[model samples]
Target: MSDLGALFYYLGIEVRQGKEALTLDQSTYASKLLEQSSMAECKPCVTPMEERLKLTKASTAAKIDATLYRSIVGGLRYLVHTRPDIAFAVGYVSRFMEDPRENH
Candidate 1:
């Protein structure tokens, strides 16, 4: 072990330690996530999803391209490993796996 106070960088997680406390950040990972999701240029919202947003099956749900939806869900799931903050939002959207609506 190095004597540099446990500075660790692994799998996009950066851990820095100091005399007072430890800090965790993933700006790099966040950037990559945005890029992978094709949202790098998208505007930032106060929250990933609106609080009142309620998703439900549409009566006339348009068919979705499963491959695309699954790809998006997979990428979001990876972010959840470290970004628990977005877990709920990601999981909420993923629930559509049974029947994804094109409008979504």
Candidate 2:
């Protein structure tokens, strides 16, 4: 076995080790996720989700591609590891993966 030195990148996370702290970043992964969802130019929100927004399993909105929806949700789920601030938002979207709609 060989050592790879400091863990700069692993899986989709970028790691930085400083004298006082360790930092984990996922900007590249998040960007790729945005591109995959065809939202590369989406705006950033101070809040990951809208306040008081509610999503339901049943909806009148038209259906969207379930595969792509699931993929994006999965990426967001993974992102929650390094970006725990978005866990609630990711979990909110994950509920509709079975039948994602335009409103999802």
Candidate 3:
């Protein structure tokens, strides 16, 4: 596509124009996502997920709503558009959407 000339915004992502290059941000999208998932009060973290931690389908933890879990995971996937760092974590969680437990 030809230069769209400073993509002001698209799909909840804010684009900032600068001399060197353009920057994409998704704070607003993230906030609304958190609020929708009732996690607005959750703390920010450099590492969104634990390292070396393993999730399994045999957990005895209580089961969570499959629909809600899928919705949240889908949002997380969308967030990867700007925050690629969380792609691994999001993908990890997505593995359990079909039968997500609290521990997942």
Q: 1-104, model 2: which lDDT tens digit per residue?
A: 99889999999899999999999999999999999988999888899889999888778999988998898899899999998999998888888877899983
Q: Write the per-residue lDDT of candidate 1 for residues 1-104, one digit (tens) a residue.
A: 65755569977778888899887778787887678667899998768789888777763667777777777887778778777888989999888877777765
Question: Judged by TM-score, which candidate is best?
Answer: 2
Which wins on TM-score, candidate 1 or candidate 2?
2
lDDT of 3 by residue, 1-104 (tens): 78867578898889998999889999999998899899999999999888899999989999988898898899889999999899999999989988999984
What lDDT does model 3 reach?
Answer: 0.90
TM for every model, in the order presented, reads 0.70, 0.91, 0.87
**What lDDT would candidate 1 get against the real structure?**
0.78
The lDDT of each candidate is 0.78, 0.90, 0.90
Candidate 2 yields a Cα-based lDDT of: 0.90
